[model samples]
Target: MHVLLTGASGVVGRFVLKRLLDDGCRVTILGRRPVEGFETGFCAYDLADLDPQLPPADALVHCALVHAPGKFRGGEGDDPEQFTRLNVDGTRRLFEAACKAGCRAIVFLSSRAVYGDHRRGETFSEADVPTPDTLYGDVKLAGEQALEGLCGPGLNGIVLRATGVYGVSPGLADHKWSGLFKEFAAGVPIEPRKATEVHGEDLAAAVALVLKKTGVLGAPFQVYNVSDLLLDRQELLALYATEAGLSFDGPAASAATPGEMMTDRLRALGWVPGGRDRLKTFVHSLARRGGAGT
Candidate 1:
């Protein structure tokens, strides 16, 4: 399959790109700058531009967005209109361009933020309706709605509401837990916070599954939550401390929340995440990389 991928240089997008390439799919990347080794078939354009002359492809995996730095939740200090134009409007334009380019299937990388802040013990499934509380969530939900509206007889759309994605990327040190690692390494006290997370490789696997499942494309639209682990920052810090041979006496364990972003829908499709084992490996790797030193 020939795939057109946006944000191929991003953390998650890079994983998806590698997975697609390993699966023997021809890929064309659309991005503002050429990826270091993938310049041969690159389209240089910003998502806000709404370029019409997109290259033809059999499918499209859209992972591009304008997110605030280290503050995706209501951190977009840009003009509201511009944010909408770049994300919501930009998504619609891209989908239309994909349709015009004869693409039959599209997979959008949405976010778990659409579920809003879950009350303690609250869990979410694909069956739950979105109640976005932040501008970022609002924009993502809008993009999903756009996909729903655009799906027709010949088009198939899938939205993966992904949770916090964590993994090591070359030359990229500021992953989701980078700050926590640095703080721990510096012996700074850390607070406890709970959240759901998924590995980038697992997310890419979900995308690959959706792309290979032709039957899913026959449906008008589909939405699935992609998450693996429900973790507390304290527990993770303890694990890191053990691996790094450091002392970390942080806050006590917080009450567990029952309401987590569930991945049953994707699991039903035979998708299994890497779970905490991957998390352990990742932490150990980070420790060895001097995340524990200074």
Candidate 2:
């Protein structure tokens, strides 16, 4: 299969690109800069001003976005107009162009932000109506809706409403937990927080599954909540601290209720995450890289 992947240089997109290449698929990357050591064809352009012309492919994985540095939730800054222009409008243009380019399937990297900040004890499912609380979430939801409107006869679309994605990536050092790592290493007191998370590799696996399944194409639009763990930040940080040989007293229990994101729909298609074991490995790698002082 030939795949056109945007954001090929991003933290998550790079992993997806690796997965696609490992699966023996031809890939064409669309991004602002050329990926180092990548021999695949590349198109350098900003998503805000995307060119309609694109190489033909069997499927497209859209993951490009302009977000605030170091933050995913409500990180659009004060410029709502530019945010809409880049994320919402640019995504619409990209989806339509992919369809016109004869692509049969598209996978959008949406976010759990579309569900807003869920109340404690609330588990989100695919059936929950989107109640975005920020412009970032609102735009992501808008992009999904736009893609659904564009799908037709032979075209199919899948929206993966992913949770916080974390893992090591070459040339990408600032992950969702970068700050926590620094704080834990310095023995700074950390506040307690809780949320769901999924590894980048697992997210890529979910996307690959959707792309390979022909039955999904029969539906005009499908949405799935993709997440692996409901984690407490204090405990997670303590795991890192232990691996780093640092002393951690841990934070008080968080008053905020925790929530789970159900992935039965994606799991039905044979998607299994790396789970906490992978998380442990990730933390170990971080500790090894940063050393005991980190």
**Candidate 1 lDDT over residue span 39-111, tens digit each:** 3377766777756568888999999988666566755676777777789988999999999999999999999
Each candidate's TM vs. the true structure?
0.93, 0.94
156-256 per-residue lDDT for model 2 (tens digits): 89999998888876556667677777766767788888778899999998888888884554577899889999888887877987898888777876778
Misplaced by over 4 Å in model 1 are 216-218, 256-258, 292-294
TM-score of 1: 0.93
In model 2, the clashing pairs are 185-294
How far out, in Å, is residue 147 in model 2?
0.7
Q: Estimate the TM-score for candidate 2.
A: 0.94
Go through the candidates in order and give each one's C-alpha lDDT.
0.84, 0.83
Residue-pair clashes, model 1: 5
